[model samples]
Target: HASFFHGGPNGSMGFKAIVNLLGIENYFGKTEYNNDADFDGTWGIWDEPFFKFFANKLSSFREPFFSAIFSVSSHHPFKIPEKYTGKFKKGPLPVLECIGYTDYALRQFFEKTKKTSWFKNTLFVITADHATVCYHPEYLNPWGEVAIPILFYAPGDSSIAGVKQAVVSQIDIMPSILSYLHYSKPYFAFGESVFDKNRKNFSVTFTGNYRWIENDYLLLFDGKKSSGLYQYKTDRLFNNNLVSKNPGQVASMEKTLKAYIQQYNNRLIQNRLTPFSDLNYKKSQTKNP
Candidate 1:
């Protein structure tokens, strides 16, 4: 499979390293970065034309190809093209207009892509790397800090529609797509398929402290111990600390979180990220036996 990546920082060390790892043909917005018209003055190229450029490049790619674009127009020091300055509605946050511009850019990209033959078969997954500034009062807590949009859309697939009532993270995206494609090979992933109704889905996030969300409860772990526990579904404000009140819940969640961390750290340290690795085999044997 061929992969394409666009958008990165000045040095692009991190992005280039990932592209190299994926064995993808390296592509970046170096030309746009150098051009004044394409640059948003704050971020690199404006999302509108950059997305169009990416969409045009997609047509040249062969079948069974993976492409990713990281947009930059809807970020800090939010600025949109002069022509669209008064177009989007203004909200409490300055980023809202920028977001609206980015949405428009994405829509334009889709419009161009719809003309392509491969657009119908492709699964489009949209998500952000992280959530930024929060304006709503309910989202002032830890859970809200990590809560970002995750959406999957296929051209005519009704089965992929509707909201799923489960705690899912970006990590689950890979497994879920593989499951939908009926990929039978055993793989090493830190997440489970969201389509597996029998499985308990959860999202773990770290922002200085670790937060583990399962069912309705959100457990806050500070490495040493579970510091705070809140029924996030009900306690949207996270005003109540149920740490002392829920010992059993704390212990169970903490145990799982610790084990997950151990596995993650060990794999990374040992350079054994694949299922075929000896570390994974040993770990699986010990767990199963």
Candidate 2:
């Protein structure tokens, strides 16, 4: 089973049969808005709760099942519940509001799950779909950017906790799971398992402005033009110019970025885009991209 936050790009309360099929909002909760473009600002939705509730279902089932809960909660125009306004520090980044809300909900959920039997036998994985989109102008780095942080938490006879700063992505989830089960490769998964020793220890981001990660440095591109390079190791905020200082570093990184782009675009051309279930995608999403 899969669910996502409401209000995504093809979500429109099931309007046109064609528009309704996009399945963009298939995993999310809907907002209370007349027009799809408007933000109704409802929180406590399909994001973290979707994960919590589905995990509950996973716990109850006698048969083995695959459940995925993707969140749109931490994405976006950052409209959160009004009750949290001034309850937490909201002045810095708008993403803070959504993150705060999601985090609290998730922590409570984690505690509840830990006390359950499923927490003992089941392999639990918690990770992010992507990073927060930074649109704030005063933000030290690039104006439009998002961060994706992947965390792996597996239950054992005793609690095991581990944290790493190494780069990871959502694509790595299934492969990691398959490997843990000692299963063979999945047919459509493009990512190498995060556990692979030979796997390159870097990250990649695909936006209109594409990015590549090699060690500590990052290179961004937008198809025809090369954007700039920065080191996440030193410039944590992504503010500063390293493109002039490092020419060779940019060359190798750009090649890696292009290879990923080609692979992604090729898949896009080949795969059929599947629409959502009746209530999923078109119930409500932003009409425009």
Candidate 3:
């Protein structure tokens, strides 16, 4: 099941295009969407309906299944259900209150699912699409804007549980899951499997400018040059730019960032994202010439 409570699969052109390209448009046994028009012109239905859809759909699947659920009550216009109006204390930002409501809904969903037969055998991965408004000054920096929680929960296996000190991102989810399932096939992905001990964990994000995070350092790059470098562990606010002071680190991270940009650009240009038989292309020649 690929269930969405907010935007349907066809809502975004980019999303539709990617799904079509990957040939995963019909991959799910069920694709559920919230039709707001049925609710007398209301948009953004509550999260409960989504949970119910997941429960009902999963019950019908006889074979192994992969599913995704997207929750949107935490998003704007930031409406807290009438039943939860005064439940949570008002925070600095309106979104925080909405977050409380959404969290409660998630807790309820889990409580109901834990009694199910599949709950003990499932691997539940929780993550947010993006972060909300930064209320604290410390989290107002470029790195902080992209900061969101990523958690993995395998009910029967306790070995993979607990905190992972390594940095990871949303892109790593697919590869990590494939690795966990012991998938033996060639595939193209921008991210390495986080569970692969031999692979270094890092995250790359771009919103107008580019930011690359590896270990303790974060390097920010504009189109032409490295503008800021900070030890995020020590400098949470990013007030200090160590680009001039740490030339070696800047150069190393810049080289990595450039390689990532080149690979991404090359892939998009060549339309080699999908692992189809006909579109045989060599590895990206993004290495320094």
Per-model TM-score on C-alpha atoms: 0.92, 0.66, 0.86
TM-score-wise, the better of 1 and 3 is 1
Q: What order do candidates take by TM-score, descending? A: 1, 3, 2
Model 3 ranges with Cα > 4 A deviation: 1-21, 25-43, 277-279, 282-289
Work out candidate 1's RMSD over C-alphas: 3.1
Tens-place lDDT per residue, model 2, 139-228, is 435423545556667766343466655666676787777876789532445566777768776666666677666667777778765678
Cα displacement (angstroms), candidate 1, residue 218, comes to 0.6
TM-score of model 2 relative to the true fold?
0.66
137-199 per-residue lDDT for model 1 (tens digits) = 899998889998889898868788888888988999899888878999878789988889886
TM-score of 1: 0.92
User: Candidate 1 at residue 98, lDDT?
Assistant: 91
**Which one wins on TM-score?**
1
- Measured over all alpha carbons after superposition, the RMSD of each candidate to the real structure, in angstroms, is 3.1, 9.5, 4.1
lDDT of 3 by residue, 40-158 (tens): 12234466555565666666666466667666577667777676779987688888887887788788878877888888788888999887897788889887898999988888888
